[model samples]
Target chain A: MNALLRNKLRAFLTMLGIIIGVASVIAMLGIGQGSKLSIQQQIAGMGLNLVTVVPGSQQRGGVQFGASTMQSLKETDVAAILSDCPAVLAASPEVRGNGQAVFGALNWPTSLYGENESYLQIRERSVTNGRMFTDRELSSAAKVCLMGQTVVKNLFGEGADPVGQVIRFKKIPFLVIGVLDSKGLNTFGQDQDDLILAPYTTVQKRVLAITWVQSIYTSAVDSKSTADAATQIEETVRRQHKIKASDQDDFTIRNQTELLSTFSSVSNILTILLGAIAGISLLVGGIGIMNIMYVSVTERTREIGLRMAIGGKGFDILLQFLTESILLSITGGIIGILLGIAASKIIGSTMGWPIVVLPSSEILSFAVCTVIGVFFGWYPARKAASLDPIDALRYE
Target chain B: MKKLIEIIKLKKDYYVGEVTVHALRGVDMVVNEGEFVAIMGASGSGKSTMLNIIGCLDKPTEGEYILDGISISSLSKNDLSGLRNQKLGFVFQTYNLLPRTNALDNVELPLLYNKTVKTKERIERAKSALESVGLSDRMHHKPNQLSGGQQQRVAIARSLVNDPVVILADEATGNLDTRTSYEIMALFQELNNKGKTIVFVTHEPDIARCATRNIIFKDGVILRESEVKDRINALEMLASIPLEAD
Candidate 1:
């Protein structure tokens, strides 16, 4: 221990690369873990209480295009399904189109969505200002619009309350009823917090002048009943569309739980890719340690021989070299861990991502450093051990 | 007294670029319980090779060497190390003490090899050996911290720590000046008088004259033998030799 400490510079030089390598693995892994966790939390915060279904078949030259031939779903179907499906706690149909809305002097072009009173319940959305449209307003096709927080901020200026004010959609007057809570940006980089919502009846009759609805959402009593409720709704919709089991349906039924699974699979693949990349860095560091150890053995050949001649055996020489290598690797591992943590923290704070340092990574990196020490330092130790005492003593 | 070391027809061979170099020709020799014998040879006479073989650092290619009744050829490496530790001591002209180690630690090394010697006993023995060599005041000094003569004394003290019967000194004064060389030779003579067997090698006639007996080697063979006069004690010889101020 005393002799080893005396050669501090040599030891430090040997460990330098290892420390950098380990630190890189740790920091990168931490950032990855943190980001994965944050994304999962963000998805969770979007609320799995809602489910959506979109059209998938074909319609000739209509707004439904070549995908769905018959647009079997409408506002009436949503009403019938809501009344027939007792498993469904609530349901709403949404219709979307490009439209220009003018409020006072500002004229903004945005995607306009039309929904019913149950839209907030089915979508798990909250109102930030004013109130949700009443059932009477939706049933009567009343001209009331719920603006997204982004729409309000962009068009109505900061701290502006546009509620109860009148706005025109394609020159038809509509009253601003409420504003949606901010949902930030999602994985596809789309702003969920930007867009406008109005009654489905109003959109079909007053805005788009179309009879077909685009999509529908339903909220179940709990997460466990989501699959059952989707099945029940799908059956009821198929009966209403008069489609047989052998033929493909016009619309698709989706559950939010399946989406959760899809997200996990993609993230898992990404995490593995990241881990492998970091592992390559560790391997590079291991090679660096090996190269330096070989040089050390060559430089200290005379000392090795001298030791053996006096009384040291082959094992003693092996131990000395082994100790030096391990010393280097362990010290480097410690430094790398610290650096990795600091880097992760910086990434987490700056990028608004979660940076979690998992325990397995710490253990894995330390073990990797040790294995690097043994594997790379072996050749030099063997070289030192096999040298003849007489020749070694003669070495300058 | 009893015979402590015996060498019979010992021949050590080496291969240098496909050419055979004979380091030791077939030779028979013995050193009794208490004797100081000097080996005199010119360069390439194989005196160092002979010393190395005697010191158990190497084994002869063919021949039997019996040290304290154990055949060196039959002993395993670890056993040979044990034999070297228990039976033989060595002194070199270069004062080959480990550079970073203090005098006390240098002397304590041989005792470390012997498990029977406890740490306390090793320390006491090392201190006594230093006192015997008149370097007790410099026990804590490393080799680089001491003068050439003082370093040689520490080496001498190291050789005596294990209390081996036979002490091998290969050109024990080859690296020092005349005055320092005589001072070392006087120390060897004193250890020899205290019933320790000395086997030293020297090329200079004056250095060879200090031993009680001298065996000359030439062409891998003994060419001459001289009976040295042992009438004077070591301190008297040390005093007679001229000295320069340190």
Candidate 2:
């Protein structure tokens, strides 16, 4: 301890390597963990037990046309999935088109979605004001619709009740029956509350004059059975389309659990990569300790000899050097932890990145510092302990 | 008188690559308690080899070395260190005191290895040792702050702090001027009068004349041995030397 204090500048410089290593490890891990948690939260907000079936791409003469171009899925697939697939809780057929909605003198461009009464349930959305359009209204091909928070805000002004108000889309008048609860922005930064929903029959017969639906959205009995519901929907759709055995699926089925796993795995790899890079810095820090210790042992050779001549045992010399290095590393570890937490907070606020510091990372870094101290400190201490008293005394 | 050191036919050989250099060849010597013995020789004459063996810092190839009635050949490395701590003291020509440490702390160094000596007792013993060497006023001064003579005095204080059975000094006055050399020799003579067994090694005949007995060495063997019938009084010699102008 006296020796280390005597060479204050050298000791602090040696500890700087360890300090930077530990701080970077902790900060990198925090960012990685924070990003992973944010991804999971956003995926959870999407909905529960959801399974979406979309028309696969059409490949005519090997020149592939992208997804939703085949028109493989139809309105009949929704009925077939609800009745045949016992795992399904509810299902809805969807058709969409872009149009400008007008209310009085106010107008805003928005997406128009055509869906049945079960669409809100499958998507885990609810009407905040008024009620949903009835089955009688759908059978009569009623021009009734529901307005999302964004559309209502743009057409009728902010906080205005658009229910019972009339809006026009493509020169056709429609009555707004209800207002959807606000959902804010999704993971992709797209506004969830920016669309208007109407009966699928009204969209197909009155708006587009098309017979086939674009996609089918369904919900499973529970979150655990989401994959099973997707499989059953695939089987029923294939049978309806007459896609024979040993042929490729004409419609692709995706479930929430599969999407969640895919996203989590990607984030997990990112976390590991970040940790490994930080670990390389830590390894370099250990090498720095070894280099400094070697130089210290050489510089103090005569001192070691004098101590030995004065009756200090070899083991005592070894213990002295080892203790010095360990003390250096532990002190650096403590300062690094504080610095890392401060850095993480700064990054979180300034860069707008999520940062979550785990207690386990702190504990792990502390333990690693001790191990590094011992491992890198061993060889030089042994060299000091093994010196011949006579030769060492004569050393210049 | 009880014998503090006993060596029978001590032999030390050094193998420098292919050839062997006989550092010490079949030597026998002894020093009884309360005796001042000086071993005098030139370089390569085995005087240092003899001192190293007596100090328990080196092992003899073919002999028995017993210090304070314990056989050195039978002891392990750790035991030899413990023996050096408890029974033998060493004073180097260069005044090997720790650089940044104060005189008192340097004096207290040997006692640090003796775990039984508590900090309080160690400090008290170190203070008394410094006082005995006439360095009480310089206790807090570091080696760099002190003069050459003062640094040697600090080294002497360090050796005395352990209260060893024999104090082995190699060329103790070699680095000092005539006046300071006599002054240090007078300190040793005073310590000897108090019954401290001193073994001083030097090549200078005048310094050898300060001891009660002298043993001369040549070609790794004892050339001659005699009692100093006309031993020089270091105090009287110090009085004869002219003091330097301030």
Return the top candidate by DockQ: 2
Q: Compute the lDDT of residue A62 as modeled in candidate 2.
A: 88
Per-residue lDDT of candidate 1, residues A115-223 (tens digit): 8888777766789899998888887999999998777876788779999898887888989989998888776788887788998888988888888888887777776
lDDT per residue for candidate 2 within B146-206, as digits (tens), equals 9999999999999999999999998989999888888899999999999999999998899
The lDDT of each candidate is 0.80, 0.90
Candidate 1 A-chain TM?
0.70
- In TM-score terms, candidate 1 sits at 0.76
| Residue pairs in clash, model 1 | A34-A354, A34-A355, A57-A67, A57-A68, A58-A67, A58-A68, A58-A69, A59-A68, A59-A69
Give per-candidate clash totals: 9, 0
Best of the candidates, TM-score: 2
